[model samples]
Target: MLLLLLGYDAINWFDGRFSLPTPGMLAAPCEFIDVVVTERAAVTGDQSAVAITFAAPDGSPLPAWSAGAHIDVTLPSGTVRQYSLCGDPTDQSSYRIAVRLIQDGRGGSAEVHSALTVGTEFQVARPRNAFPLAVGGYNQTTSAVRLIAGGIGVTPILPMLDMLDRTATPWSMIYCGRTRDSLAFLSELARFGDRVTIHEDATYGPASAEELLGDLTVSSAVYTCGPPPMIDALRAALVDRPDVEFHYERFSLAPVVDGREFDLRFASSGEVVRVAADQTALSAILGARPDATYSCQQGFCRSCAVRVLDGAPEHRSTALSPGELDAGYFLPCVSRSEGCLTIDM
Candidate 1:
């Protein structure tokens, strides 16, 4: 018995469950409703992607969400990640999200891929939509629409396609991926038929602006979700088509542009936070105030909006109105300071 205790029990050799116990599975807060992982399915042939479906524990209807909406998923490791809602928004009973394994990412995708079982429990914040369909109704506008998706970026665009098709809106889309097997949501996109274009980097060598835009010379509304490089190329291409209403959302943070290094003094604690030329003020300040809240790192959401107490703040966020910016409100996620600035965070 002692040898058995030392051999298989102490060392745990027979049933090797060497993995650590995760947090939030046994007892979660009352504030967050529990959603059990109801199903997990392979979404890509590469075995690097999965679609997870969750439902309320009590079979109650979940919160209603729209296309381009995302929810913050609190993982077992206490990591919070935002995933786009790829399922039909009208299906209020449950929600589905697809995740692609990013080996070089911050380990969130790897956790989702390896740890999320069908019966796993987790919490998800209420859905928030930052990038919404420009035209909700088909009869409201006559302008054409262009939807572009890159790789796993197709998650958010899937619901958009559903909404646009349901509303009878005229639109076309370009889905770019490294290979045909690497792309997710192909079955969903296939229903759209010739309206969808599949551009594989394996064959096309990467989509150029011209290939992406594809005779989009008219004054149309263009919506895109993809990697930063794809978004940047599309942005540069649209520089000439000023009439096109360009709305884009990417999974990654927007690169800080034209940032100047400066010191940020907090009004509450008088803590001087240094901002690097390439780092966002919000990113730098998080080291000091871990309790600070922010969403939509792209600056569309005003979750990180702080009041400027002193010094000059270069307002780069598109969220704040002219009156809001003039009234000392600034978004640190994208805004920077020219001089030593004081803010009431």
Candidate 2:
């Protein structure tokens, strides 16, 4: 139970609780430290999912985490990416996370797939949870729980399966991927007996959220994580069940925005750049200073968030709420300005 307060906030790991707030997040930014990779291996036949175990550089026991917790790893390309902890929460010796390479992703996945190896070390932030199991505040009883995942989204739900089974709490899972080969941890998920149902897009019939969640009881809680399109469909399908709490983790950004051309003025650099209708503020900023810090160019990751000194922005990111927008913070990756804007680069 190592509870430490490195700054204004504390990462309390006592009693199985840990909190590491990131910048552009609601809470203040917390400390991030270095960790070494103990092992790295491809778990799937297609070699798309790479499972890597991380431990303290000095071989000290890492912090304890519960299901649905994720760690931010600084990839080799200097891109910070968040991955779900798919291994056992009871294992305090080390932390394990699976990375699924996205063919078209913005280099983070590619770096994780190719660069990470045994004996390699990288910086990782403490675990954080935007999604949690049916615990104290969830209001979900132990009677029944439903978990759903789309494609690589299954990473987060993997640990929940073990947690539910340990408590003897009845639960089920719906995993949907493009093809059978693309599904990671199928053998691990198969041990759940009839509790897990997988849907492959290559098959004539794909998994249907309506069919699986249509009969869900009002008392049940549904946890899902996936791309924006799949999540949007699930959200729309389950709209009628307001009593059912739908917790989700989105990996990618929302659909593209129909933005209008605008001007972005760097307050310190005295440089004004034009953002075309099809261009993003990040692209314009990068053109000005190629060495600018950024990752997950999709608005989902808050790495590109900057202080807005002036002008109203056409907020397209789900990461920032109305209060955050009013607080002079914005994600330049997908967020645009109304006409003219000034930012702190």
Candidate 3:
């Protein structure tokens, strides 16, 4: 199966063929309800686990989500961040997610840690799932499922593990992090007994991807999410196991490339902004239009994607595929222009 990004949506491109959502299918209404943070605690030494409750101001049930689903949170500072739902999918009263503070990050995690508290009111985009679990393992030929997660990537996997356990599916997990103290959901995962393996970098150093995945047979299916390096290593190790279906989700941004200064012409605003070699097009665009809609400034989310009207674009983000570029879309958060460019804004 091939995955392609066209604008902000992910299209399942299989065997050089795919179907686009029709106008009616793409026009579902969404509600951004004001949710109150009901509980907040440190799940790990460094990660803060938060639970937010949502209900209609007039008392009605909020939207529901599946395992591996995430919601876009608008922070107190107006910075948008996406967090995977780690709590019970059956609980319609609340949603839980873990946030790890990134000291060098663009202030989203920091704002989440400092500003969010019990009783604090916040707004979030309804849950959306880009990484969904294949119910009962999509590979009918396989009965074994392998789940792998690294660092904070374990958030989404928690729900999958829960569903699998309840269904009595044959599955196992490999969880890795810098240290035991940095890992979350330890006590819960412990219930799975020997089926789960934890690897700490400080104690065990790095776990061999090949060794961890070597036992998987052609009739096995694997799902994993983590930093790009770990994902790349796992993919390389399992390259020979094409018969075993692989599902992955990556939230980290691609490395930024050195870019030259370029002129950004906004067709809608009739404004011209200069993007410097050391700066991002987002910074320039947001500086001029503070009301600009954007999220996940690291280029993980396609919230800042725009249509290119002219000139060549130096696409630095992993958000868009080759097909998306050919369709004239570019992510301004991390991507820059090869030369002068005009944007639809």
Candidate 4:
């Protein structure tokens, strides 16, 4: 027994404890609190133009965050919505979020317009960022940065503009809206003079993608946030220039009319499900098992990520990096399997 243990057992014991390093622990989700609205203000003449403030207990500042971070607000109706942090990051007395009522929205904004009042208490999520400013070496060069905003998509760009202003970095902004009366932050944008350009669709046709985005150089970066049509147009216009960094955020999901049906197999659970053309990969998974947990099903959130064991996945989500995708990880929310896929579950 001692001789046998000295051979294979010794190698196995050493490999178990000392051969490989322990994997790093996963990051824990941030916590948020329910705060009462202290003040409300209407910046624009429109009644929908509203500003709400939330304060932490003892009147101390909330957690420090970088520019371009957005806080998730749970309205009185229990609807979760994300609003960009419009207040200065350095000033932490309270968090500020500006909201405009979307008449066509599916009850979220409508609830805020009718139900939210001063002194109302609602749950709020800590600031999370999808859009972070490129700094250091990325900012040292005098590369042209263009920001295109449609309607409320201008929220995130506000803080970005503040950063650019402080750094004295040259940047340009093109804001498009149906009319001046409907647009928010008009006064603030007007102060930027020629650096900011406004295009009202009522007077002139919406800005053309090709015309607005002329020839692109390798040093240019274009950030766009808007409706599907605006994003599609920008993507089409810049499809030829792959070198230029194009960052965009869509407020709503794009309509998916054409997708092939596929099969998804979970290796760990030994479960398999067929996904239809009309059903998203996430929808199929959650339908098969109601216990599935996910946040931000639009692919912006990395909550529903799983490891791909076999087959290639058509990467559609924005959460994972290119290297991560190459390593067989995918977000089932907006992504689908190109063929039959086996996931670790």
RMSD of each: 13.0, 7.8, 7.4, 13.2
Worst 10-residue stretch by lDDT in candidate 1? 4-13
- Scored against the true structure, residue 254 in model 2 reaches a CA lDDT of 46
Q: Tens-digit lDDT track for model 4 on 12-62?
A: 000000011112111124365867777776645556667677786467667
- Candidates 2 and 4 compared: the better one by lDDT is 2
Clashes of 2: 0
Identify the runs in model 3 with alpha carbons over 4 angstroms from their true place.
1-30, 45-59, 137-139, 256-292, 297-302, 311-340
What order do candidates take by lDDT, descending? 1, 2, 3, 4
**What do the candidate models score in CA lDDT, each in turn?**
0.74, 0.71, 0.69, 0.66
Among these predictions, the greatest TM-score belongs to 1
Model 4 ranges off by over 4 Å: 1-28, 43-45, 135-139, 214-218, 255-258, 263-274, 284-293, 300-331, 338-345
Cand. 4 TM to true fold? 0.74
**Candidate 3: which pairs clash?**
none
lDDT of 1 by residue, 243-331 (tens): 67777777666567787899999887888989999998878877797656654455654656777889999887666778777778777
TM-scores of all predicted structures: 0.80, 0.79, 0.75, 0.74
**Quality of model 4 by C-alpha lDDT:** 0.66
Off by over 4 Å in 1: 1-32, 136-139, 266-273, 286-295, 300-310, 318-331, 343-345
**Candidate 2, 1-345: lDDT as tens digits:** 111111101011101112233333234244577788899878776888888988889988787788888776776555567678888999988998887877776566777778888888887777877677754345435456788887777877899888887675567888888888888888899899878988877884656668546467646667877766666777777676656667777766444467889999988887999999888788788799666555545554465677788888887767776777778888777888778888876
**Cα error, candidate 2, residue 328 (Å):** 4.2
